[model samples]
Target: MATTINEIIRDSLELIKAEHLNLTPDNYAKVFCKVAKQKGVIVEDCQKVDKYTKKLDPNIVTDMKRFNIGNIDELLAFLVAKLNRANEGDALKMVNTLATLTKRVLQAITLLHDTKATSLANASLERLDFHQNLQSIDLVKEKWFDFISNYDDSYLKKLDAFGHVTKDDLEVMVRDLIKILSKDDSTELYKTLVPLIIASLSPSIASGMNDELASISNELRNSPDALGTPALQQEIKHLISKRIDLDKAEVQKKVAALDKILDEINKKILELIQSSNFSHEQVKVIKKDLQSINFQQDSFETVQVKLLNIASSLESETRSLSEKMISNQETITKLQNRISKLESALLVAKQEVKEDYLTHVATKRALANEMNRVEDAFMRYKIDYTLCFIDIDHFKMVNDTYGHEAGDVILSTVGKILRKYIRQVDFVGRYGGEEFLVILPSTELAQAIHFADKIRAIVEQFKFLYKNERINVTVSCGVSQRSQQKSKDETLSAADGFLYKAKEAGRNQVMPVL
Candidate 1:
């Protein structure tokens, strides 16, 4: 007698347990089929599926194998998806063909030079533009067919008035006429506008941009036609942006210097007030008024005006003390000399704040400021950026074997290398000892990685000479994109993480393995 279904299931479970296999459905099914076959009972379902699969198209069979479709349900879903995708491809092709047809028809219609023909062409072009996708292709086709059916040939008669003029000749004549009109309009407009623009720029700001402005002015006057090209327009825009950034940087430097000067002057006044024995009530009142000025809360102009008034009062009061304080004349002269020296020192301090003393590149503080600025641009304008975190390999060993002086040389050389390779807009800074951060504005991850690798290769090939001893050096770099991270800090962390990974995977390489 044939094995009963209950007996087959019982034996399948026993076999699974005996073999120490997991009691999964697939395992149970295989065991059950094996036991049934031993008892002379054929499982017809497996046979049916195999037979059906053999009848499918070879390409479909290959696709099933490629996708690992093991059962009928999955196979059916895959086939349905494949069919849907094919239908979409066909629909896209049809839409593209329709668009091309409509564009060609419009081009042919525009050559007739009739007002009605031009209007019809423009309307059809607008409709085609509106229906740019497969979903609206049917409506576009209907409108295009209607336009083609109603198109009149009477417009061609106007062309016959120009005796023996071929269609090609008419086309050339129309194109030449349009070109002349466009050139004259653009040239006259530029001529009238360029002088006014140049005149409006402040002499102080425009002094540095004289060459750029002159180049542009000459272009407008001599080669106005070239300005119509996209390349020339982009060059002009770049020059404008460069000039704006330069002016902004100069203004910021001046403001920072002024701020430092004001602070120093306030400190000197306070010191003089504390040390002075003011016998006059007016001198005491002037000191009290000077102390009342709020540097932090008040605007720069307001602070300047108040300080000026206080200085005038102090000047008048001090005149009376000149005879009484004659013995302190040397001290006063020394203080004046000290103030001058302090001014110079303050300027140097400001420079040091932005520049690293050892590396001569930007300092970490400056890098942070740049990162914040770049982050603002990213957040506000959707402009993307990338960071490269670089660490010199075996730097500690270099310092140990050589000396701290040699290490400094290495750091300085690396900084110079980084600065040399980067663009004007890109920033490279000494993040800390033996490490650097490069901020690449408007850069992509892949491009940044490539850049980092190039830097790595350059450093590896460079020779470090200290005390006439050659030292071999290499660097590991990590790169990350701002767009890939949720925050600027995260982006920096990611770059650092990649840098660590690069160091771990045998230094002197760029991270993310690519």
Candidate 2:
């Protein structure tokens, strides 16, 4: 009996899912290439597809009989038919054909979500590298360790809650961008393992026990009730214990290396905390803030969300409390005014009872309580905002032509422009060189896109000066909005994919995904 097409697609998808591949365009090509080799489907021809597909050009399969690269609708229909016919013996042959078809469709969709994941990884790393205050044992061992450990999909999920990215979004996103300085090709293991490690750090993007994982877990289960629980529930704990048993020597070696780093950071923190020249009150406040900024998780996304939320809440609460205190302080002004009036009305009215300036200081304690409330609220709502990633068009050319100094000026100038256009409450940060990330609290994608367009327009019209030369700049933007229960990394990636299209379609445009 001949195998059906849908079955082939299903099996292929399962294979990808089993391997935790994100169905990226590049990975999709790889999957097809693997399938073709296994089924002996003109491996050389498949290699041609891989070569052309990697370039992301559309002419790769112009002559392939099974593929209709021009009509996505027709191609998808045929691919679906092939998927319905999947079987173990002939599955690879059909999947290879479907892969060529899907690759075209995906290229149109773009899969920059992997890129976004990469971005988040870099952002989280920046947070770790620049934090500068890791002085206590708790901060060093607990906070930093936890931040590094949990830097996977969960971070993206939290960002999604903030309305930045979504899950399984059919768009190209740039995720997990690790900077590779070393040229040794022997680093394939390092390259592959690094992204996986970074992805794992973000619990949001990390694949949980899917059907394939479930099968593996079932084989390892010791109890009849194992079916009820996911293997990931005990994944970390189990891995730790298993490593202790199977690779005790390796664990000890890493422990010795890690201990040296921890001691150095702790010593630095202690020195700052114990300085005799600093005021006792200042030390107390520093300690208090340090205690509040707890880093219990190993994921950078987790740490960033927690720390930023806490800091923002603390600042907001301080502002609110200060406002109220100012209002109360107005009463003192009124009383002082009244006392002046009495002195003017009566000759030598005994220098009106001396005002006690210290009385107002009591408000600080009350303000602390209000700050706690604000911090708690912030923690709840940090993930409830929307975020957009914006990339500047031909920014490198600007840098290369104008030099890094001029590039810095351009970046600073752009930052000011974005700040001016965006709402003061919206969070805008330099996502790195030539890229900016914006977080909109309580705003959806449609509203965000409108804002993005405004930024694009303002940027296009703006001119920068390097010495006497006038430089005009424009930007290409991709806008992605997060769905209610999706991963932020994927959503950001989708927006990034749109941005890529914006560039491809021509620079200086806003391409927002619906």
Candidate 3:
């Protein structure tokens, strides 16, 4: 019988939970490493942070137990709590690294899933007579509802939730799968494995192809077009691991060694000419003769013993070149890894300046980024843009009445409302709790007021329901345009001042009076 993909996912999740009874950062990493090793995924010391496990605080384990990072529903709550007291980067890394390691666990599950399918298919064939097997194989095949209800696609989202996965990670994962499945001879499973492994490797090949990799890619492409055999997966690991080197230094050294050999012949010729007490013309003739005894296919060495000297030099250079090429390949491999590290570091930096985790709008850092662009436009073209500083009226009441989770829902909903209603050219970002910023380009003061008023009304009318409790939400906006402000800060201050005025006058209103 075909098992639902969710059953596999649930089992996979349970397996992780079972691996370690306590799911703190330290225990999580330890369990992850163990699971990966058991599943045939190789981990270099450079890729792990096991040594840091000793440094974890005792309090974190206790706190994590209360929050229960194991439960998906409580995950955000745990993160929100951690972010308040922990180093921001450390908190994010704890989440991101856990997600990344869990991907390895999922890859192992995929391999196990493949192995199970293979065993079942083989069993079905052997259990039946040949003609009966041909007709009854539909039992092995999947059904329509199996396709409809299966949740295999959630694995991709689950993997991407906390970390930025790369092509190299995918290739390594697929390679492990291929190694484990190498013994599976079932033609049915071979068809399944070929495409999955190929798909895993496709992104790596497509994204990072050089001269040598292109040839391998063509071979992989050709294999799928043909039998789509199990052997295709077998060869993919070898193809991806191939590296080439053409060492110019080795070539130059070889040429220099040959030159030294030729130079020795001239030295000996000069000595012979001097010892023989030859005339000046005879010395010139000897020089010409030695030069003529060149290292060429058509030439012959008159000194029979010199061939050994020249041959020895040639052999030495060949050995040196071979050694140099090996060294170069190793160096290139390390360089590629270093480049991946640098790219990953760059990704970390980019991740810092992104949408608000709680609200899903532009974070404060992102707001500053957008402001810089808006400033650039205003300076260069003298273009005008409006900035509206918004504060949710009586927002503290929502938190007081409905709880923080409901408040979070209201915040996120308001962000979505402002983000959705704004022009694409405009910008909307969450400034802080209960505060938002919106920028409208080329808009007059009246239009800015009208737009802010419209958003205020939308938020007021829209209902936010959390845990069977309904709450009314409204926002007060203070509007300012860039036409008169001297700088970005001044424009922001003007909007902020008006926002304060609006709040002072009464909540739930737009402050259009400059």
Candidate 1 local lDDT, 305-360, one digit each (tens) = 54455456556656555444546666566646755665566556667778999888
**What are the clashing pairs of model 1?**
none
Candidate lDDT scores, in order, read 0.73, 0.51, 0.60
Best by lDDT: 1
Candidates by lDDT, descending order: 1, 3, 2
* Candidate 3 structure quality by residue, lDDT tens digits, 1-514: 1344334435545666664245565454445545555555554641333333235576765666654343333445564676675576787798668756644554455555455544554544443425344345455444322433453544555545434444236676556555555644555554444434433333221223334444444454445443354665456655455421123443454556546644664464334334433333343443454455444311122232343433333334333333343335564355346535644654454454576877778888778867876676466434468899989999898899888888889988888888789887788888988899998877888899999899989988997889877788878899998887888898899999988988989878998653
Deviation from native of the Cα of residue 410 in model 2, angstroms: 0.3
Native-to-model Cα distance after best TM-score fit, residue 503 in candidate 1, in Å: 0.9
**Model 3 poorest ten-residue lDDT run:** 296-305
Global Cα lDDT for candidate 2: 0.51
Specify the poorest-scoring 10-residue window by lDDT in model 2.
Answer: 353-362
Error of 3 at 87 (Å): 99
